[model samples]
Target: MCDAGLKLPPNNEKLQREEEEVMHGANLTLKLNFPQYQSEVEELSVKSSTEVGYVKLLIGQRKGITAKNIRIFYNGTQMIDPMSLCDHLGVSPPSIDVDVYINLEHTIDV
Candidate 1:
């Protein structure tokens, strides 16, 4: 995926007429989602939460791997089952590519 290369939003107190129109137009537009394979995501697990594809790419750019391989593990032991990897990772299929969802990261649930 290409980086969104999104620019910063205008500060609320200083929007010009043109800036206001652009911001409103952007808000009115729709976004699309792209599906990802469960098998593909599952294949990259260094213990579910960690993805091998991500690691491989990182390693290729860093220390290095000659075989171009990936492995899964539960806790510290090796795992071959996709279910095992997914169970720990909670991966969902047909994932959303673009999100308009609100961020709840800093919100307290209690």
Candidate 2:
């Protein structure tokens, strides 16, 4: 429930090393929450540049849900298809402490 965004410590060697690794195109680890399922995906590794739509697709595939049925929200704002994590959070090379909400669409067939 932290909305403070990413806070980089001053000259923290461990964080510095991790930042360097990410700068070399290392994937970012995200904590994905699925409220309806009452579950969470801890440590979901993804590129900072990856699109929100693709992230939904990836999660959908893994969770056995349809990509079109997924909706992602950050900081109370709904994340659209083209926005990347960097764009949404407005920072990169991150140990981003943001919580993402996943809304699963419940469908009914006639």
Query: Local distance difference test, per candidate?
Result: 0.32, 0.66
Candidate 1 ranges with C-alpha deviation above 4 Å: 1-50, 70-74, 77-110
Work out the TM-score per prediction: 0.22, 0.59
Note the residue pairs that clash in candidate 2. none
Off by over 4 Å in 2: 1-26, 39-41, 97-110
Per-residue lDDT of candidate 1, residues 1-110 (tens digit): 99889888766654664565343321121122112222222222133233434433443343233214433333444433323223344333323112111122432333
Candidate of highest TM-score: 2
Which predicted model would earn the best lDDT?
2
In candidate 2, where is summed lDDT lowest over 10 consecutive residues? 101-110
Whole-structure CA lDDT of model 2: 0.66
How much is 71 displaced in model 1, in angstroms? 3.2
- The sequence of per-residue lDDT tens digits that candidate 2 reaches over residues 1-110 is 97899886698888886786567444676667656656655456777777888888887777666677777766667778887777775445444434444443453223
N/CA/C clash count, model 1 = 1
Ten residues in sequence with the least summed lDDT for candidate 1: 26-35
